[model samples]
Target: MHRTDGTRSLAGLLALWGATRLVLLLAVFKVYVFPGPDVTSDVLVIYQGWYEVLRTGTFPLDDVTWQYPPAAALPILSPALLSFLDYAHAFFVLALVADLAVLALLLGTGTRPGRTVRGARVWVAGVPLLGPTVYARYDVMVTAVAVAALIAGTRRPRLMGALAGFGALLKVWPALLLIGAVRRRAWAAAAVTAGVLTTLFALAMPGAFAFLTFQRDRGTEVESLGALVFHVARHFGWDGQVLLNYGSVEFLGPYVDAVSTGALALTGIAFGWLLLWRMTATRFLPHTLADAAFVAVLMFTTTSRVISPQYMVWLVGLAAVCLCFRRTGMRVPAALVLSASCVTMLEFPLWFSHVVASDPLGVTLLFVRNGLLVLATLVAARRLWRTTVARPRPGTPRGSAGEREGASHADADPQGLPDAADPPGLPDADPRGGPLSGARRGLTSRASRGAG
Candidate 1:
């Protein structure tokens, strides 16, 4: 592990940065820039809207098509603006901005160590969109709001919520982050976000709430992780196809059976409640929030009946934010998680078909990718668990969330200098998980003054 003593040479850090960049560039070109799925990812869906425009007066609405929230519909005009130019040119412009938005948000938190460089390296994942697949899709737009929420979440939490609210309008993932607000102040921040976005949703799309109801009546698909459990029954040639509920592969093998989804929902809620109650009552603070937020993403990703290829885009955005405000002690482990995400994208976006046909190549690649992430998750979980079990830092026998904000009050810098353990905001930059709340042991002898 790199020492907190800051003794590592800058050259070594830069070398690491350069290597990671090379990997990202290769991944981008392999997946997006070159001929492959990237050709179709974004263009097919977004261009469909234009088809609707030609047939009807406006884009398709009140339909099960995109399954997107109303707010997400607003950004389509970003590409539409280019109709005066060329529609293709407009798509490219929107794609570039959306892609860069992620990079900008990552680099915007410049004070955190390596955030800019690591951010720049991580930013390459978006490059694949230059390929037709991603460029045409709205994934980048969702990433923009998710990244914005992460960047804004550092200190101005209300800002975080608002950005998340905007994202929620697009894809519905950011809405889950609202559960992270435990403190009354955090609730205030989230409420402000709700108030602002809700007013806009009402004004712009008066019947938007009806869409939510419409979504509930919809059926599920077979692509989600939850459906994996039901695959065996299908393999056995169970004839419950039309008899099952809308969701894929119901355990009960009946259309009337909602038990699989219902049970999963109850367990998810219980798990979330336990994390919040156990961590707060025990005063475990920010690490709990970070871990919990990551789990929330996992739950959604795993539970959804449809895990599209584009879903990885959401994880990429949130994961970067997680690394930005990482537990100072978990740096290496966090990097490993990033490496796994990076490698997985390589297989998923670029080499997917080749992998499926080349069974050994595919399985080996999957092992390397998921294995690394599992290693990182274990390490991060250990760090969080240790913190929850360990003694308080010396000189600070007790602490409060408000106390975590006090250091920023004294620091004149706008970046919100890091707390005693690491650079300010460095450990709390998670998008939906919330911010770090801790106190330093030696503030009077401080030398650091940036986010990292």
Candidate 2:
């Protein structure tokens, strides 16, 4: 698409998304005020109390459980700035600003050279489709940081690292974005991340680490994919119970601990698989880092013992960033990720009672959402593998020793910057070169000469 057309389309999409979010927020806030059984705005209510505590000048208020990292205190406490606007309203406004910031970043990145409008569409469609959960939770703020990091990964390595580190302080997942950086860039980003994290930790001190103690004894949250095993087991006459625990629905009974342990093991396996893929891949495209980061987050989210509805926000945000690349090859997988976000809304506020009751509808919703996630994960992994690992066919004459060596070195660089010659499947920038270059050039010339 032309630059002007793409810009207009993105603007319209953002406008529609913003309107949908506003409508959803108004409806949710009504429920919050009226106190209804059908819809509960627990995040807003919970943060209201947290905000009150923080406003009192006592950090990490002893009366409440604050499980987030110290940097989260910034957003959590930001509502204090508008004490005149009531806690819920103030927090919602802050979240809306963060949401818009992320959208703006996506649009800016999408318009960059070698990028596409697909990423902007993902953000515009995915966020509001997830419903009010996007605004109610603080995950959107962390998402903004993540979007900025991915956009800067190729052009501004240090900035990307700094954002990732600060985002890690807000939530640990942004650190995954660094996985896409080239070796030197990766080192630079990691160093900045470490430095920022260290500074934040030193400033926050004991309170920064407090969440570790609280998280240590947490159980298997009921919404997790692993919790499905227990859900099915309950119907098979196994004795177990689901209840609210650790600020989320959780399973507690026979084999609950075992299931939780198994989930952790799966997470470890996922990490190992990511490491193995990174180490073994033979080629790297410009989209490699974004694709790799998406895979890593998918593995972490899918295998974890907690799959909060808001967690989908993280996935959606990262998936949008991945789509920004022209050759990411994640179109189908990105659609599935968006589909899962829509299902996540259904499983939450709309039919949460069904989930809590383990009704057929709730189970089906969970199944579909989790199934979509699984499919997206598999599809993305396959695309990454094919693009980076699959070798050329036999009898395809390899280039000179130097060119072959250059390809290998380039693959390992992480940045995946294009060389002067056009890549095999891509069109040449210089019209003089026609389309194909290198070995393909000789083949084309010989075929034309033979035809004559």
* Best model per lDDT: 2
After superposing candidate 2, which stretches have Cα over 4 Å from the reference? 1-8, 31-40, 55-64, 203-205, 390-404, 407-452
What lDDT tens digits, residue by residue, belong to model 1 across residues 282-309? 2233334434445456445544545454
Candidate 1, RMSD to the unseen true structure? 7.7
Clashing pairs in 2: none
Model 1, backbone clash pairs (residues 3+ apart or across chains), number: 20
Candidate 2 worst ten-residue window by lDDT: 427-436
Off by over 4 Å in 1: 1-42, 45-47, 50-62, 110-116, 125-133, 178-186, 218-220, 240-267, 270-292, 326-415, 419-452
> Clashes per prediction?
20, 0
Report residue 125 deviation for candidate 1 (angstroms).
5.2
